[model samples]
Target chain A: MPNILVVEDSPTMRQLISFAMKRIPNSHVIEATDGVDALKKMSSEKVDLILADINMPVMDGLKLVSLVRGNPTYKEIPIIIITTEGAEEDRKRALSIGANSYLPKPIQTQELIRLVNSYLTKQ
Target chain B: MEKETGYLNKADEFLQMFKKGEEFTKELLKENEKLRYKIAQLEESMERSGDEARTKLYEDRIKLLEDEINSLMERFKQVEEENKDFASKYIEVEEENNNLANLYVASYQLHSTLDFSEVLRIVLEIVINLIGAEKFAILLMDDKTNELVPVASEGMAVSAAPRVKFGQGTIGIVAKEGASYFSDNLSYMKEFNPTTPIVCIPLKIKEHVIGVISIYSLLTQKSGFTNMDYELFNLLAGHAATAIFSSRLYTQSERKLTTIQSFLDILKEKPRR
Candidate 1:
């Protein structure tokens, strides 16, 4: 079973995402409210993949990326940034800071599955 | 002789007076004509100078204004061209993004029945096919223990894989912070795995941190990941988290219902007093 982490700020959005992940079999999906909470969760749990939002309080997605990439222990992990900011500059900054992939807001379920599958299969 | 001399003197005086009067009238007429001629000449000169000066000033002003207008027109044309280019590029980007979003939705609907594991497998396959990545992994967070656990992996050794602690490894950091992380050269950092280039993203739900997803390149020769890759991964992460969460809830509910049913059956089996 692949352990997946989902970080977002909205309850409704979180629920929607959790519902979508149910389609996958034997996958464990976890949730966090913000970057600070996510960091707290990371200290104890072993996670395989990360799905994150950019505009979050306590620690924005960009800052989280820099911090993660700076750590040698978790540097190899792939990070996917989900955000409402669709500007090219925002995407560039996310990638430059160490994000594995970027996705704009209002994502489609199939595209999400495709991206996740790519990472799962390669490992 | 005396009387005749006096009479002749008086005549001479009268004659002298008449000549003086004639001379005065002639002088007055000549002065008037001279004055008229001078005034006419002066007026003509003034008119010529005024016309010439006015024409010269008007032409100068017109030339200056024309130059200003031409420069403004050139600037306007340049601005128009720039606006057009910007509009075109914006449309192109919007179209590409729309296509990607559509593809994502279609894939999600196609695999709606698969479980989380299957979804992860599908995700990895799609990433490899679409992004040409050689290696990848998915790390999920445990809410109870607050740990990041590996759920799925490909193109890597499972036995030698290093476990990422919450807030410790790159995956942990992303999970904890609810953000994305990437590195071009893993070898440079002591904490990074021996991989050359790596990228990671946090799966988020309702602004919550759920898990982390990562991809890496074993060979140092491959080009590092780009912003587009991060965007795509983020999209997948969101959907993955949602599906997994719902599945877990459903399983929990099923288990509870089963337990309750067993207890009810025991009660029903009891004999009535």
Candidate 2:
């Protein structure tokens, strides 16, 4: 079972993601409100993958990426940035900051599941 | 001969006296010439002093004028800078006002369309595009069950069959309160497993709460919700409710008219028979 950390600010969005992730077999989804909360969780638990939103309060997704990458303990964790903005610049920024992948918002469930499965299986 | 000698002596005396007198007059004339020359030099010096004083006064006046001109120029520059700043700010405010006006007009036109579903779809699209929400859903109140049922949705997959109970979930809470509600993280909510930030706004028609509009990130979780997002969602909900209400009224009237016409036709045919 892959342990996944889902960080988002919206309650509806969080529910939707969690609901979609729960469809996948043998996956445990943990939730965080923002980067700060995500970081706190990361420090306490071992997460195989991280699904983060780009825009957030307290700390943003991009900053979370840098924090995760900088920590040797969590450096190898696969991180995906999901955002409403589909611009190339945002994708590039996320990638440059050590994000494993980027997904745009309003994501289809199948696509998200496939991506998470591929990453989990590959690791 | 003695008389002639005496006359000559007298003549000599007169000539000597005359010569002496002439010498004295010449000296007097020389002294007068020197005095006149000194007087002329003194007059020249006075004139020169007067001219120098006049030139100094003119220079002082010019300096004062120059200083005044410089100060005025600096003041003018300051005023110009202030004006430029004010003009730019005014333009920004005007542009914002124009955008708001355009949004209002667009919303009005969208509401005027006869199809309720289309109007709701358009409103959702507009709200999503404006606020950049990842997924959005519109749940209307079921008159019979009094539950919030998902009528239209975008960016998420909602079960069309399951009607969430009023005051059970975030959407229901919003409907129950007849107000807008926001949760940055659903995981914190006891009713819902925290997954992402959510914004839910109630749609009211003539003070009667009818439905709710909710939006959130489907794939990833946002860090937190913003006040601006809440305000924008509230505004969108208000407009959507009005449009929905109007469409419903139009449909009701249309159906009533058709029913009345059919009834009248039947009565007319019977009377003719």
Candidate 3:
């Protein structure tokens, strides 16, 4: 069983992402409000992958990426940055910081499903 | 931080401010390539494996990957609300700048002239242009009737002639008390049955209120007045009162001088006789 964590602050967006994720047969998804919440969830169990937003209160996704990459225990876990914005600088910093992938906001359903499916199949 | 998206409607060009985090596109693309490389290694391992145990391990990893995809699909739902909050906070700062600018202009133009007509014109300008009053009337205190009467007006309904008594309506209430009365929503107040909202600001000098500035409605949003609107009203209260008073005094003095000179002319007529 693979555990994936979803980090975002908006209730509406979280539901949207969850609705799209149902296309994936039978994987368990963890919902986190921010980086701190995601890290807390990670400490208790195995999170195979992470899907996070860039801008969040308490802890943003960028800082989370740096911390997760630094941690020996969770370093290899694929981290995906899901953001409402995807500027060039944002992409470079996120990738350089060790995020495995990124996705822009208002994500299309099929595209989201396809991308996640591709990453999963490859791993 | 200010919490409202109302200001975003005013500046559509700046909507991109929220999208400043766009760098994820290029970075994610590069990351995908790296993932593909890793995938090739995984495929190679699976292809090279001959032992049943090694084959089982590859299958296990592939199965795990399939499950992980489901969870990764659901990401960042409530985060946009936070972005909206940030945008609203920025807009609040912008609104403050606008308030200060309007205050400065209204104060400066109020005392810019001593002529009565010019003084009246500036009052109308401040009311209409700076304060964004939709329909307004400037009423000065009449010495004989001890009444407040309209000197100049714009956008007032012809049928809704303002004949407010000393203690009647919002206009009269402000005049009697010499205090400003503002309401964004008039219908909600107890016993406040006005046809439309009208902010009544008493124009004052020291303790004396010389007149009332009646704002019939706001041009932008008539629902209510912001703190900045009240600040403008405060400026008008003191500055406008003094300006109108001075202009009236100047006109009165000029008339007095003319009467004095004509009397002197009558007295000097003996020389011609």
lDDT of 3 by residue, A8-34 (tens): 775434544655565478777888999
Residues B1-273, candidate 1: write the lDDT tens digits. Answer: 999999999989988888888898788889988988999999999999999999999999999999999999999999999999999987677656644544464356424644555566655644543344556676677877777677777667543345577887666777778877776565543343622227777778878877776776432223444455555666666776776666656667788899999999889888652
Task: By lDDT, rank the candidates, best first.
Answer: 2, 3, 1
Give the interface RMSD values of the models in order: 13.9, 13.5, 20.9
TM-score-based ranking: 2, 3, 1
**Candidate 1 wrongly placed segments (more than 4 Å):** A1-123, B1-103, B106-111, B157-160, B186-197, B218-222, B262-273
Model-by-model lDDT, in order? Answer: 0.69, 0.75, 0.73
Instruction: Give the alpha carbon lDDT tens digit for every residue of B116-197 in model 3.
Output: 8788878776665445565678877776777777788766643354656666677777888998877656444333223323
lDDT top scorer: 2
Looking at model 1, residue A97 earns an lDDT score of 93
**How high is the lDDT of residue A83 in model 2?**
76
Alpha carbon deviation, residue B153, candidate 3 (Å):
0.7
Per candidate, chain B TM-score? 0.54, 0.73, 0.58
Local accuracy of candidate 1 as per-residue lDDT tens digits, A5-116: 7887754345545555655677778898788777777778877777888878888878878887898877877788877656688889999999989877555455676687
Per-candidate DockQ vs. reference: 0.02, 0.03, 0.01
Highest TM-score among the candidates is held by which one? 2
